[model samples]
Target: MPLDEESPVAQVRKNRSWEYAPFVNYGNGMGGDRSNYHFLSLGVEAGKVLTPTIHAGILSGQFQLAVNVMPFWQAYTPAPHTQTFVFQGVTYDEPVGGGTYTGASLTPVIFRWNFLTHSKRVQPWFQGAGGLIYTSHKFPPDVLVPHGTPGGTSVWNFSPQGGIGVHYFTRPRRSIDLGVNAVHISSASLGDHNPGVNASIQVQVGYTFWK
Candidate 1:
């Protein structure tokens, strides 16, 4: 028996195959305090072609560890020379300090759309994602205070972000992707409080698995 060239079943079978990819990315953070960070990520992506021109998939990546610290200053005054110093209404003018700390644990969930899946050599895609970020900092020695001290603080916070990227397919199952992402993590404090935001760019290489 001969098969019809225009049969819908044959078309469906051709589009139902699987695909996957692996990639790496590098970009700088934007907004809040301007800073830079680099990331290395690897994952498996699988998708079925719903139509000749459309495809979709999910991705998960892990961040080993990273550090970020912003220089900040605060005001303080030494104890009064005498009890009458307070009665005299004395004021201190020296203020300002510095500190450094380390933070880790940041990851993202990704969703992508392939609009040019039908093309043989060149394919373009768009993506969007959101995830949680965990960060903490250690105060400087000079900033530490006694049990009753009321000015020093330590912090931990959560961050959320999203971004877009374009994938250029070099082979039937491989491509290079480049994009940008933005993140926001609320501030944590032991004494004083402030919120912070981070932004970066992503570049990756992806491979597809077919059934």
Candidate 2:
């Protein structure tokens, strides 16, 4: 059946001023390879709607734009994984540690592509966000060896992330969000080392305000 054209969710056209998104991120353990490096993120977003919701392509309400300021808190442990190597015609075994760590980040831009329909209660979105993160301690030496400084990691790292999520609305212009995200942390070659750590799959829950 066709949905009500006048439903608040259907009629929303990016007419709102700002949105607040508060979310939590659960790391997926870097595709199941590493377990000790899994991190959890508590985050929030504030942004201005840049475009009206557009019905285009295979997904309705798929095209939307917003500029956001995002802040996050993250915590993790650095459990070392074992690595075997051949050096000087001999086999060597080593422990590659992830190390215990805590950090925070501030992202300047967050772009969301939302899939919308006439459904007034549910919306789906894909997102990418980038910015800087600061840690209380340097990253694990293993993470910095190949790409970064051999013995130490940087406290200031470049952060990049992507994810998918869905929002369920209980009332007009408000929603509860759930999703997962993957994140990478490194100094991007500017901080002496570039060894990077890939956080495991992240779980997220948040609330959104569309006004």
Candidate 3:
């Protein structure tokens, strides 16, 4: 017998899909420095049909490289200044200076998320993920307590992130997603040994495969 043209099995087979895209991120550190930090990433996702109104999928992405410059210190002050102050049995005037510190991180991991997919060409979503981040530092030599201090140390840290955003599908199988994501890296103290919180707002774009 000839199969019906509008058979449900045919529609189900035709709706299978996948998606991917390269993304760029822009935001600030916990300290609110609007530096131009950027990253390149590739994401792959697979979706399964649950019902006409529902779909679910897992997403994973790898960051090729991520870089940033952050400021640490704002100013420095010395104890009460006196013209006739004696230091090491010698009279001298102590000078005070102010500066900032900077750092960067580069580590990649696979992030997984289960999304409640929407049907509109433009859809909104929310997801949470955790991964490993390798962090590094770059501080001013003069800014350190002692001179001739080395910079650039890498540490392994865990990052947990979550966000909500809208996805715009400009083409049949491609879309641009802009959203705000909060990423937290466990405190890492190195060099001068200062431990602090590091976080950022992430923006990304992605393309769908077999849409």
Candidate 4:
């Protein structure tokens, strides 16, 4: 049948030169309310086809050498610590907005080798990303350091991540993704404080615009 040959995931696999995906991710490990980390992004991708088709292998399917430039990034991380203390006649109280680490980021690049599967309806892939992020304030210390780090958090940090995700197609060249990613934020010891926020798991949902 024509539908069998021109499947949605197949069209996605054939989109070798350029593509786009706008995604959102939500993360909360310990509690339901006090800890919710989220981000919204638009990924601009470019790649070349590894082959016309890959039917069988350790990773069987359409393999692409893909690179994504996430130009727009908005992140939210709610902190869990709010303790007050005074030293040398100076009072320090963790602010309320410290729990709401809201900020914007631009262009965190990711290089990905995608192993799209043979199934017409579904495709699974694994990827890793390393980039830098700049935040507005030095608050929301790493969870391990609930009392806040010495000199507070850095305005700039490095992000390293790895994750797995699957695409489910609803029509030709169109799909939604369910993915899990692990993200880390740290200063790379370049700043006054290097304590980082490590969210072991982040869940993401997204849509692909294939070309």
lDDT for 211 in candidate 2 is 78
If scored against the real structure, what TM-score would every candidate get? 0.46, 0.76, 0.47, 0.69
lDDT of 2 by residue, 94-122 (tens): 65655566777777767877775656777
Q: lDDT scores for all predictions?
A: 0.38, 0.65, 0.40, 0.61
Off by over 4 Å in 4: 3-5, 15-17, 29-56, 62-97, 142-152
Better of 3 and 4 by lDDT: 4
Order candidates by TM-score, high to low.
2, 4, 3, 1
Which has the better lDDT: candidate 2, or candidate 3? 2
- Model 4 sits at a Cα RMSD from the real structure of 5.8
Local error of candidate 2 at residue 137 (angstroms): 0.7
Minimal lDDT window, size 10, model 2: 141-150
Residue-by-residue lDDT tens digits, candidate 1, 1-211:
2222333223323554454444333344454323422333343444444444323333221111111222221111232222121225875442222332334433434455444333344444455544433324322212223432222443444445555554444444445555565544444443363424344444445443334
Any residue pairs clashing in model 4, and if so which? 79-99
Where is the poorest 10-residue window by lDDT in model 4? 141-150
Better of 1 and 2 by TM-score: 2
lDDT of 4 by residue, 104-167 (tens): 4443455454565657888788778776766566533442344444354576777788888887
TM-score of 3: 0.47
Cα displacement (Å) at residue 20, model 3:
1.5
Clashing pairs in 3: 18-209, 19-208, 19-209, 20-207, 72-101
